[model samples]
Target: MQSFLSKIKDFNNKHRKIAPFIIWIEIILIFLASIMKNICRHYKILLAVVVVLIVIGISARHLASVESKTPEEGSVVAASEEMSVVEEALQEATVEASNEASGEESLINVDSAVSETSMENVDSAVSETSLENADAAASLESTASLYVDSGISEFIKAHTEAVGWIKFEDDLISYPIMQAEDNSKYAIEDADGNDSETGAIFLDYRSSADFSDSNTIIYGHNMRDRSMFGALKNYKEDLGFLDDHKYFQIITPEGSGRYMLFAFMDVPKNSYIYDVCGDNTSRMREFLDTIEYKTYIDTGIEPTVDDKIITLSTCTQKDDLFFVMFAVKVDD
Candidate 1:
């Protein structure tokens, strides 16, 4: 030991500059080894906390992004503008009717020239009102068409898997629905294929992409942040909620249509309702009966075997339970 210590001191004295660097390297290695030992001892709990923080942070950031992009006030303004146009047309019609009534009352005593002038005024008002109403209708039609084409096209451009948009009336269930090669693709990924705990609303891998199937099934995560399909659980809380929000819209590239809520229930994760390709009418009816039996609310709208239906499903708090909403497509 004395001989080894003497050699080490002799080497340090000889290579002073390089020796200090070697000493620092040894010290760093020892410090890093100590840290590694501590980390290994408490890794499980630390990992859980880190995962939780990451999820919360990601959820917070995603929600903020969604809020920033949503044009709540803009939609209100546009709706108000549409209402104002209609109201103005109605008010003008009322005024013109009053003028006509006054003109008719005076016709018994007025001269021919005055009568002719009043008739001309009334005709002009009618024509002007007609033109305004026509213009307003055209404007509304154009806006709707633009929304159908441009909005869907833009969404498709963002994510090729995005087949359409689904929205529940008076709820936060509005989201773009995507379809991938497999259902698992979007389970942990968003529509853009980005990692997200709040996965994209997705059509069942076995379902028809055009929603032409007898029963189409869609899935989403029940994120704690009230995003994705989290608000769907609200239906189970209040039967009146189902009544108030009895319908939802599913907009596709081909056209826009609506679905009326018929039933919502919770079932085992492997319930037969997930079978999108089943075509047996009697079996389908039996399945529908089971769903209605388990429903939280009675929508009074029973679906026949020939009727097309859609089911929106998500996981519940129970590991084995899943919540589902069933609706039938209504003619627009």
Candidate 2:
């Protein structure tokens, strides 16, 4: 009996890590059964009760472990609700800002109307008034661009490896594009070096950080959550999605610019479009021609060899297939 109890104790200790509470409950029930057998005449009843308790305890533990591993439906709903609340708040704030801007513009127009009347009264002022208004509008646009660049610079200061920010007009593709010594650094890791399935959008390892390359390549994961570059698949579902979202913006420390999307295609994993350094004007034109041919829809925007281009690539439904979108930088 001593030898048998010793072996049972060893077994319990070995499996304690896997199910601590269940092991402890089994031990207590067995001890109680042993005591009940000693006190009562019937040992079979106590033995059966202990066996039932052990089975129930083990089954409950197994169920609990499975539940812990699976994601809860309620949690997903809560997250989506929070995101909707945030988006709604942002939309309301944007509408308020637009109303305020309209109010300011109306006041400016009133001032301009009074000034025009004065200019009409004075023939000398009429000659230079239109030019002055043009100059002021240009200055305002320049100042706004400068302010946006400054904000991006401030963001880069906090995240040194961040090369630039990219955002598609009507998609959830807004993310900071990062580059490291190797492309694999951000392939499975975020900007903060945390392991993530949907990693940060990253520039190609061979591409320049300053966006000086002929064809800059950016990559992101096509997450099932519709995050990262997952929304890119919408183009395949609705061809008009491309027509509605023709432009994406990239803001660098140097300046901010827009890119007009001209083509989207699915290519093999080893396609030449992944080549960053081997591109020349002739090669780029050939590459553009191939993209134009493979594109699902003709955007009617053609690119010249001199224009700088960007390619956003992500995996498609197949592991070996890659979906890529090509766009040319629009001259500011």
Every candidate's lDDT? 0.69, 0.68
Q: How does residue 108 of candidate 1 score in lDDT?
A: 21
The sequence of per-residue lDDT tens digits that candidate 1 reaches over residues 1-332 is 99999999998788987977888999999999999999999999899999999999999999999989877898979987768646544544454465476544112212332222122221111112223333432343344345454677677776788888887766456677889888787776666576544556889888877888888888877643346676775676666777678888888887777899888888888777776453434568787788778887776778887888888888764557788889899965
Q: How much does each candidate deviate from the true structure in C-alpha RMSD?
A: 27.0, 22.9
Assess the local accuracy of residue 244 in candidate 2 as a C-alpha lDDT between 0 and 100. 74
Per-residue accuracy of model 2 over 106-225 as CA lDDT, tens digit each: 111233331111211111111111233334323433443453445778657777898888867653467778898887777766665765445578898788888877898998776434
Give the CA lDDT, 0 to 100, for residue 321 in model 1.
79
TM-score of each candidate? 0.54, 0.54
Candidate 1 matches the true fold with a TM-score of: 0.54
Q: In model 2, what lDDT does residue 91 have? A: 39
